[model samples]
Target: MNLYPFQKISFLLVITSTICLLYIPRSLGAEDDEQYLNCSASFQCANIPNIGYPFWGSSRPNYCGFPEFKLNCTGEAPVISFQDKDYRVLDINQSASTLRIARTDYWNNVCPVSPGNTTIEVNHVEYASDVQELLLFYDCPPLNIPLPIQLTSQFNCSINSTANYINYFVTQNLTNSGLTNISSTFGTCNTTVTALVSQSASENLAMNSTKDNLVAVLDSGFGLKWDASNNLCKQCNGTGGQCGYNTSTAEFTCYCKDGPNPSNCAGKKKEIAIGLAVGGAILFGIFIGFYIYSFIQRKKKKLAALAQSKEIPTPLTSKSVATPSTNLSQSQSIPSYPSFTSKSDYDKGSTYFGVQVFSYTELEEATENFNPAKELGDGGFGTVYYGKLQDGRVVAVKRLYENNFKRVEQFMNEVEILTRLEHRNLVKLYGCTSRRSRELLLVYEYIPNGTVADHLHGKRVESGFLSWPVRLSIAIETADALAFLHRNDVIHRDVKTNNILIDNDFCVKVADFGLSRLFPNDVTHVSTAPQGTPGYVDPEYYQCYQLTDKSDVYSFGVVLIELISSLQAVDTNRHRHDINLANMAINKIQNHLVNELVDPLLEFETNHVVRGMATAVAELAFRCLQQERDMRPTMDEVLDGLRAIQNEDLGSEDGQAVVLDIRADDVGLLRNMPPPLSPDSAGTDKLVSSSTPPSSF
Candidate 1:
């Protein structure tokens, strides 16, 4: 056909566009499939004889598997730096998408140069639920007092220990029930390491604690689940093709005998056909639209030139040649206001993670200008005030201190962490003002009743409203909330009776996230300056400056102690040696002087059931108060222990046993035991006031 210039240009443009679009995808797909033959061969090491897909090594290319899943087959078994740490892969279950791996440095020896926790940094990798952590304490000073049975399982790691220092290994199931009056004798350790082992293996090692047993556990390794390209791999295999990753495109690709396919081998030809057809149709439409636009622009210019030649500008001015100001004047003359729509009345509200964002004025009015009468209580970072929101909902507004750098950090940290977390026992976050507001304020659901501290020893102590059942319920709920927080990787650094709020209905609400921290997934603990309530702080955390969820366990231990004794955590009026409640608790429980610590109001002398429950709880508290963080049970363990003590069904299908040793009748037999050594004669009455034997609840 004899076509004009525009037609010829349009034809060439359509052909070029179609060619580039159709050729690029095909070329890329061809390049990606180059490794099809190479990846078809499975990876093999000495023990792991056959592994494929999502794990490439040695002879395999990068496109064969995920970058993070690459293995180093140079050694006897497959070695992979799964999460920035070298691990020896013992076996792989392709069907289950799991791996059995052991730490390389601790293969034979229990000591490592820079021992670290096994952390899963990649999204695809996760420790199986059946994995349990084993703790190793190294280079601890020999105690002047005899070591407790929990710490007696000593292994001499000469590399990390010396004549003056020794090493010890303990499992997660170990408790501090055997600890004597040795709280003062607990010494600091140089290095603490955490290792993972299968739950079955850990339970099996519960009775045996020799060095060889621990080394064998490390050699056996634990489990990990890999979910890389799960669906894609299934689809690829179903279509009789091999599944692989395309590093260039950062996507899953299917490899067939013919070539690489975007999805599956069976659809390769169909996909290419569709791509070409769609590209051609799109290019033809674009070509037609461009031609029409060019013609119109060209015709307008020609008409303007002809009008100028005829010296007639009226039609051009009236129809098309309007000045910028003239156009603006016409728009202004339109009836905009009469039919104008409003912008849906924004109440100056915003949302963060589904948490409402309030204005400064609204919060100020809700708090009645933060009146002193509205003051609720003081907190780690700010003061809380009772307020009612504009929506007629009661709330507790936390007004932080003036705009300091730390204040801003805490404000943001609380908002970010609280908004994402949802637990029935946890205090609900309603909203907060913007970071750029006149002042930073956080609004929470109002918990009308006072804190647990108020009932224990503060304003509400005389009421004796906290009975044995109520106290036990509080402990379970608090542990539950803390466990939920730990599961979500949150550590409530300041855990005390004061931080435990009691609503009007007596439900426990754990507040105060200012001192809480979002623990890093890569480490067992975070190394930071210890900041917690004085009597409730973890002694190990304070000494070593390492914070972990176990620190919360230690603090909760003090809270448990408070519930049983109704004694303040810090009582200066008592014996000088009994200043800190945790220290007094350790001494009394170890010396069989529990009779001295029980609150008289709990009726330890008459109620045998309450006595038994109290003693069992005391034992659990002692384990939590262990000088070593590893000796303390996890929050989940604490919850399980409490549930077991209360004889309540925990709703767990496995029905995990409580590790604590409780002796209900052992409480009243302390009459023959000698009195606790008192350093101050004047405080003797205060220490020995309660003669009723402490019992288990």
Candidate 2:
């Protein structure tokens, strides 16, 4: 084991050289990391400071972070696009992995006046746990709820001046309690939307009850956390390597002292090895160029053939017609439909509603040339034909008669109203075709199940009787639809069983808005000739020329009574005293003879819960049928009452009589109701010219 002095010295020198060679890369890598991290210069946007990885923009390149997380500095604010929606970035905290964003449309107040469809679609970012949602209700009808609920940001909508300034109330709780209970607890409003608000902003809303405070809180926006995993960046920074991404491979790359590599600090020797490999690859690529070119040409041919196979045939027209981008333009040349004479005229009709204009040929093909076999129903103004479009969409095509000017007016009115209206419980108007035919045609979403009238007392009665629960749901849904309409300053004007269609699931879809009147936001009542079904018309409206939402409430009351008694609104077979359903229902309810009017199919006597719900409904119907317009309850109140009855029914079935404790101040139930008219008033019923006939379509 003895060694010469020269041999030991040589061994120690060899050991020292090996250790120095290994330590060189680590010390050099640390230096490289500092330079790489500087690639993403600390960016300052507005009040936000020190933004770097996971968010690249301004002076930073895409390789520094995710490309989708790019921010655009517009004016003094930094804007980011998430799922195609632009949001203003308020603050960024890299340590917390969170960012504050406010919807650009909301901040600018460029969104629709209604908040029903206002929703945020966050991509790769989630709302923070402390986020609070504020619900804004616009153009809501006057509700008789408690003062505190009513006082929540009651201000007129800038767009809808006719409306009693829109009411909005913010809530942290969204569970369904009862219709009136919830509407009263939360202001009676339509179109609910949730927005994320800061804890301080929410506290401000609670402490300060001013509209300015609400606007300030909403403008301040909410917080969102990102899934930014910075492990690679940290590792690269620690190793003295610059963190970046390989564009072609979309993989993280570390820029070291020597060159770029997939891992931290691959030193000078590896860089030289990579350079030699690159030179060899370049020479090999030159040799294979011709073969690669041939392969790409063949691939291109295959792609062209595939595209040709998938191409749809374009329609042929005389004189090389230019394709129209919109439905109105497609029908503009058709001289038969004079109503759509110009682009401006068509725009006036279809622009506000955003309804499509189907080509005449498309409708003709969809409806099989209006074949009689496809006919769904016939009405006074038009005939509805079932049709399946080329797109596999089933629709109801109503081909109007347009026999008179009045009929044409109705057709135009329906087109204008239905296009603007959107609700789950309301039938959707797909589009309209007004060319290549003598009559105007309207397309609506086809509901496979028949109308409430058919299911209850009309042709489809033999199919099966509706259960109490189904009937109750229809009532609540219909009420909700009406309330939504009223909130938007629209009156259905024809709320009847026939107008209430059902889907395959027995869900209500309120249809037929031909007679609907758009009450201006500033006007409480529109002065028009009274027009509605005879038995359902508000008596006050029948006697006077003025029309209000209460008129529809009267009609809905008749529909409610029909749900209970399963009788036609104007059934003659009933005793002469009970001919008009509204009048008869009111009389029976006042006399405490509601049980006698219950539908026999309901089997009310066998179920105590059913009996109580039926009685409660009858009372609600009575309130709706109040002779004076002022005495009638708002549709919001009606929906709440129906929900209360449903909840109570469900509760009773569970062996608990859950009395919905709706505060008296919330409900404001009418008392000391006027007595029903004597038999003489019924005998003296007179038809007036000012009264428009019932909806036949």
Candidate 3:
């Protein structure tokens, strides 16, 4: 091992085909910049921005990139992949400003020796794409967890035409925990991973090898970036902060940035005092207390009327839902409480969870004396206000607007509903206040991510589109929440992605239970007025007014369709013949033209997931759209089916042995697909309005 000989051997690592591939640079380090830009554009080779280190380009180093960084274009739909680990390639995430990739189970069920490392042991990854960027996604596994690893080192770009179809792969001995961000939506086995390119010769020869393992490439966002000398998020002269924009509501709050307080932002609301007397005159021992007390009471009355007028022109009035027949008195009519509770005090103090009543004066200050700027969103029961609590917590406060007996019933129902429910995916109700508004006021934890509808359609956000797999995961998680609701005998009369709010990690929470109903014992169902979105509304409910758990099922089916197509529930364009999504999907399917109904974003996806989505969603939408009240799957059954669809296995080795079909009698409204179309009638189906169908229909 002489120094001269060692240097020669080191040079050989690049030339050797078995391991290292020598990369030349166009600018400086050939081995670092160009290697990871192979998958920036199409599955084929394209002009990518060559950037980064430890990965060189195949072409010129300075002008374009280096040679080692050059990626190969394999198959008809050419795919960009790593030179050393051809099993993986770059996955472009347009929103996160980075690239992402999963490990390949190249040695499927064949490992010679186990890597004792418990963490995710991905030693080296190939950095090559048709395009280039400096962002990446990497969450390596720990070495301690023993994986049930198997090896079959088969790799060749030309071997599989649809190599990208294999999204998940198996590392035989790796525990479930070793898989970063592992979700139940995709199969649980480490075996769910797939390689970007295929290799036949390696697989054939590895059969007799004593030890074999698949070392795949991963293109996390950072792989597309170059070494930063300073900082990436640096501002020109001012400090930097996380992105945020909410002009529609004229409200925006970004993350903390550098300044006098490098880690805090501007916002404040005074706290309300606790358990203090309503009126006190200790300082007026001899100063004619009568005049002072009268003046204060008159001023208080005027202020009360003024605040109510600012937010609502009419006096505060609501029915006490607990006694649906009896309406509650307006706040103006209630006996006046003392002024001991101040707005400034409570604004700085955190509001307690589970039923904290805020005095009228305190609420006025929190909402800027009912300033128009504080409004959030309003609905059937009341208006919601986005306010800062005394404790410095941001909260959404729903103020009940009751003037009649029915409104009172609804108010009571909301209180009972919030108290009885608790789940990770449900909004948390902090204490409520009967004295704040006409009837009651409910405060909830603020979700920064906003509603699912905001991401899919809002014009303010940029990183909102959902990747295929991510959409599947969202579908499954939402189904789980609905399942919980059904299990507790609650019927979510209105369900839509708009009602589903998301969190930082993309967790889903169903909101706005304004129309929700509790299923009573001995009563299988109840009759109610028509509710829900126009297109998503159940035809049966409109006809007979009979509402059941299936009402929720129908609404969820519409959500599924919306997610897959990224289309609105209501498509009123005259160009589209005024056909709604339900009719559009049915017609397209009947014509055997499923492409017209599915999303275009999934054009590159392999396996049944892409093509199969139309069929699955169509079927669900069809069942939920049934014109008969007695026909349709229950929320429980729909949830199960949706979950199964979410965790579907694309690879040959993934599915568990079981049939998840709803039973013959159990299959209600969704029992059949679009009515069998006649050959001559397939071209088009007449569109119908939702109001055309009734419950008895």
Cα TM-score per model:
0.47, 0.44, 0.43
After the best TM-score superposition of candidate 2, give how far the Cα of residue 165 lies from its true spot, in angstroms: 55
lDDT order, best first, reads 1, 2, 3
Write the residue-wise lDDT of candidate 2 on 486-581 in tens digits. Answer: 988888877888878877567788876654677898878976545556577786674445689889888899999999998889866867556678
Runs in model 1 lying further than 4 Å from the true structure: 1-347, 403-410, 648-697
Off by over 4 Å in 3: 1-353, 404-410, 435-439, 574-578, 604-609, 613-617, 650-697
Q: What's model 2's lDDT at 267? A: 45
By the TM-score metric, which is better: model 1 or model 3?
A: 1
By the TM-score metric, which is better: model 1 or model 2? 1
C-alpha local distance difference test of each model? 0.73, 0.67, 0.46
C-alpha lDDT (0 to 100) for residue 496 of candidate 1: 81
Residue 207 displacement in candidate 2 (angstroms): 68
TM-score of model number 3: 0.43
TM-score-better candidate, 2 vs 3: 2
